[model samples]
Target chain A: MKKLWWKDKFNIFMAAIAYLTLLFIIAAIGTVIMKGFPHIGKSLATPEIQFAVKLSLYTSLISTVLCIVIAIPVAFVLARVDIPFKSLFNTLLDLPLALPPVVSGVCLLLFFGTTAFGAWLEEIGLPFVFTIKGIIIAQIFVNLPFMIRVMKSTILSVSPRLEFIARTLGCTPTQAFWKITLPLSRNGIIAGTVITWARALGEFGAALMLAGATRFRTETLPISLFLNMSTGDLEEAMAAANLLIIISIISLYIFNKLGGDFIGGTRGV
Target chain B: MIKLADVSITLGDFSLKNVHLEIRKGEFFTILGPTGTGKTVILELIAGLYRPDAGKVLINGADSENIPPEKREIGFVYQDYALFPHLNVYKNIAFGPRLRKMPPSAIKENVQGLADMLEITHLLARFPGTLSGGEQQRVSLARALIMKPKILLMDEPLSALDPNTKRMLCGELKRVHEKYRCTVVHVTHDFNEAAMLADRIGVILKGKVKQVGVPREVFERPRDQEVKNFLGVEPLKAVYAR
Candidate 1:
């Protein structure tokens, strides 16, 4: 059957919007690749750049792992159990996502940098100001919301009846969660972890404010890009930007591959 | 024996008020009610999944207020089976015994025996998602049976099956009940299911037990206007026509 003009018009309009969005992304990324490809050899040879890359990888990995560890229980509680101030808890948890990255970093600095508790922590040898630990702390603070959001939605998709069945079969509440709930939410958990890692990797303003963009000390990939660009070293900055773009594309690809089912809701029994 | 004495609970819009019931040992008790009448709530309460807002639930003449579902030695089968989709049939059946820390050898023996009894030995390697409704139903029964629970609670276990599948499984259910003599409290909206499997039936409407008696008595002679109206709409014999 021949389609109607009006019917095809809506389809064409939607396609136009999608293509326009894609065009913007490709243009933005194409400029960096064209400019940065030639400088890749020199940019990678720098000790400072290498240090930033290594530090970013390790810190993001640690923070992502920590986010998963904390998110599992928090997601389960939010998904399953009832609490007194649940709305309050949800609002507080989501506040980080709403705040600007720089503002969040400033808030973290005030709380953990100059406070008496921060002093006590320093006394115990765990400092969170202008250090690698500060970078990790900031990454976790920024990425935790993504972890919780994905994990909570995934946990909610799994039926509580499965846990009830487990409990009836002589497994405790904790056992039920570990055996049934966790394994069931595996796909979502993986997707969440990848998204959290990607978010942490791309974190910049927070890392700069909290860790202070040092030369070879606490510099991350984004910090490296900024520091290089500040000295009019556009090639190295573009190189760093291209690297970030490549990592992001890879992360996004993995998320899309694993996330179709995660977003579609729970797997069928 | 299983008993609910003055049990009252308010869940969202539904509330059960001063409910009382007595189910004897080895009896197939069916709580007959329409959908959304809190039939599953009663089963959960008996299984210790939900605590009653007021009064006591007594299992074997002991107050079960403090006992958790894990310690209750009960088996619950949901309408949708609630099988672990990640595990194959073998692991799903063996989950309970493994959780109890039983030896590997004993778990294998118990699971194998139950699988044979339920005629699901061929489905042991398949996942629940691949199985037909009837096959999944049998696997669910096997999973619950392997635990050898003191009481088995089924919440519309066969309601999701087709007519033929439902009929076949109902026969299997009767056979299993007769062989094990496990006290079962099966809740359903279908009166024909209650008539076929129940030694006694309790008419529940809006979380209230209107009548409790043998199937014939509950079917032929409802005690109250509400029970009469509920059963009056659909005759018991007509439900078995298909």
Candidate 2:
């Protein structure tokens, strides 16, 4: 069969776009490896690097758990409840995503520094400036919007009638949430947690500014990489970058595989 | 008897104004109306899913306004079946009794008994997503009936079924009503279904009860032209003059 001329042009245009996209992605990966891989083995195994990695993983995990525990309920209220000023609540939750990471860090610092509330916290024996706690607080602030947005969409996709049916069947509101709503939205929660954890893990500007990047103390992996690069320790910086890349890729892959089910379940109407 | 005395509610895009209804115990009452006529809203109001803006709902001469849905002693089945996709048929049927803190043995017996009644015993272990439309409908019915509520409100329960399944389920529903002697207020837009199952038929239009009587009375002796047209029994020739 003879092909139409426009069809050939359309195919060529589509091929060009796909090719460029793949090329861009490959270029990014090549650049990271070329600049970072040579020092991976020894630097990754070093005690300081190991400590930073462990601390970073643990803190990000904690921050992610805290963010999800708080954000899921907030997202549900935003999506499902008839709270007053609902638009305002949604805008405030999304503000962090729009702000730069350093701006977020500054805002956290001002709120949690030796200001009045921070002083009150200090008096209560809960200081959160230039400490590991500050790092977690910063991560939570930066990653919260992603978790909330994911969870809000997920909860919105569920028909409210299902919960109503459960309620009529004698389940309390809380029981219905746990037994019906939560299980139905499991894929969204999982995808959101993965994305939030990845975001928390790679947090740099906020963690450095708020946590002070002190070696063997408040230094998370991203902060360590920044500190190392600034001090001309190229090998250590490259190793940390490589490790971050590896972790991010694996997390994103799993997120894509599982997140597909969530999006697929809600595709047309 | 469940009675709605001068009930009024203004939901978005729909309103029920001075809507009055009395569903007698052990009677199969069908609320027949076109889409957006507030048939489902009436069921929701009775089930305590929505509070009326005005008037009172009395169940056996007691006000039901303060009672939450779980305590309202009413069972509701939605048009979409609303089966818990996460739960298998058995768990879905067992949910109400479990929530009531019934003993495990009793819960099992009630669920199995209802499943057997609906001929859904083979599908108990399967999740709702795995069941056919007819199977899901039966499972939903079983779940609602296992609660043994004071009354049952079904919102267009057979609207989603294929014609053959709908016919079969209509017969099965009649049998179920006879066996349990449970009062049923079934909502449907189909005139044939109303004629087949309802002891009394109420035609709702624009949120008002235009007519309520036995099915033959509403069909053969409609009080208004709207009810006659709605029942699809009007002559094909035009009756209006400009």
Candidate 3:
């Protein structure tokens, strides 16, 4: 079919914006790659760099697991249950996302610094003050909302009638959830897990304030990048940045390959 | 026997008024209504999916309030054939029996028997997404029937099929009913479908059951002018003459 001139103009306008956005992203990534690709292997030779990579991976993995454990039930409740003050709870769940990372870190620090709950946690031998454990806590605090939002939307997209059908076919509520809803929303959950892991991997301000970038102790990839750059170690800093970018790209690739639609303002599962 | 003793429920804009219905065991009872008449609500309430705001739903003379749908031994088939897309047809049909902890041999026999009956034996390995609408409906019917529910509730199960498929499935439904004699409450807006299958009809309009009688009585001798108009029939006097 032949297209009209105005339609062609509109198409060109949209394409131009899209290409401009793509060019900006590519240029930024290319700048980092050109500088850091040569130093990536060399930077790994430093024990601090090794510790940062290992710490980031371990904490992010642990936080993602924790997020999934909490998000499943929370997402299900948000999607299905008729709880009192539901909108209030939803707003509170998303409060961390609205706050700056530094503010979130400050809030966590205050709550766990000298409160009764903090004393109890310390007495129970799980002190979350400038420890690897604290790093995980900060990561979880920042990433939990992302996982929950993704999972809740995904579960909502599935008709609750399907669960009702399972119940009628002789399944209890829990049984129906496990056998039907979980499998149906598996891709979305996996996508959420990947996104959460990526976000946690590059978490900087909260991890810096709460965990305190101690060398070989609580330093993560982003914290390591900052610390190295401050010390005039540009190569090490760029290597860390490059590593984070590569991991995020790989995570997104896996997410898309597994049939996970983008979550946020974009269309999603 | 299935009884709704003045069951009523109101959700959002849709409401079911104080409605009473008694469907005898082994009878093919059809609730005929237009869209937005709360027909599906009645079925869900009977299946124990929705708790009625008032009144009682009794199965075999016992209140089924505390009984869950699965424990109530009621099977429900939705309009869209809600087969679990993650499972193949064989697994879908076997789901109920597996939940009941039937032995492997028994589950295999039951699934195979239903597959043969529905003539979906060759389609067992296929997923629901691959099957035609008619095939999915047959599989859904088999899934519900394999549980051997004391009462089966179907909500416009054939509405999505083509006319030819609908006719074929209607015959299959009748044959299945005649053989099993398990009580059936089928909901549909199509009077012709009700006429072909229902042992008795309950005409529901605006959340209330206006008439309950055999098809001939309801169609030929509508209680009032409203029913006559809703049914889109000639005047009652002319219907009687024909």
For model 1, how does the per-residue alpha-carbon lDDT over A1-269 read when each residue is reduced to its tens digit?
Answer: 98675468788898889999999989989999999988888988888778878998999999999999998889888888898899899999989988899998998898888899999998899998999999999999988876787889889888888888988888888888889999988888887787789889889878778888888888888998998899888977887898898888877777767764665532220
| Cα lDDT tens digits for candidate 2, A17-81 | 99999999989887878988987888988887998899999999999999999988998898888
Name the candidate, 1 or 2, with the larger TM-score value: 1
How many Å off is the CA of B94 in candidate 2?
A: 1.2
Candidate 2 backbone collisions, by pair: none
Predict model 3's lDDT versus the native.
0.89
The list of candidate 2 runs beyond 4 A from truth reads A1-7, A260-269, B234-242
Q: Relative to the true structure, how large is the alpha-carbon lDDT of every model?
A: 0.88, 0.87, 0.89
What are the candidates' C-alpha RMSDs?
Answer: 2.9, 4.2, 2.6
- The candidates, ranked best first by lDDT, are 3, 1, 2
Residue A89's lDDT within candidate 1 is 92
CAPRI class assigned to model 1: high
Residue A20's lDDT in candidate 3: 99
Q: Which ten-residue region of model 2 chain B has the weakest summed lDDT?
A: B233-242
Winner by lDDT between candidate 2 and candidate 1: 1
Candidate 3: segments with Cα more than 4 A from true spot: A2-17, A262-269, B234-242
lDDT of candidate 2 over B1-242, digit per residue (tens): 99999999999978999999999988999999999989999999999888999999998899999888988878898888999888888999998898889999999988888888788999988999999989999999998998887799999999999999998999899999999899999999987788888899899999999999987777778898887777776532211110
Put down candidate 3 lDDT per residue, A1-269, tens digits, no spaces.
87674568778898889999999989999999999999899998888889999999999999999999999899999999999999999999999988899989888887787699987998999888888898999999988987888889888877898899899888999999999999999888877788789899999888777778787798899999998899999988998999998988888777676536534442332
Regions of candidate 1 where Cα sits further than 4 Å from its true position:
A2-14, A260-269, B233-242
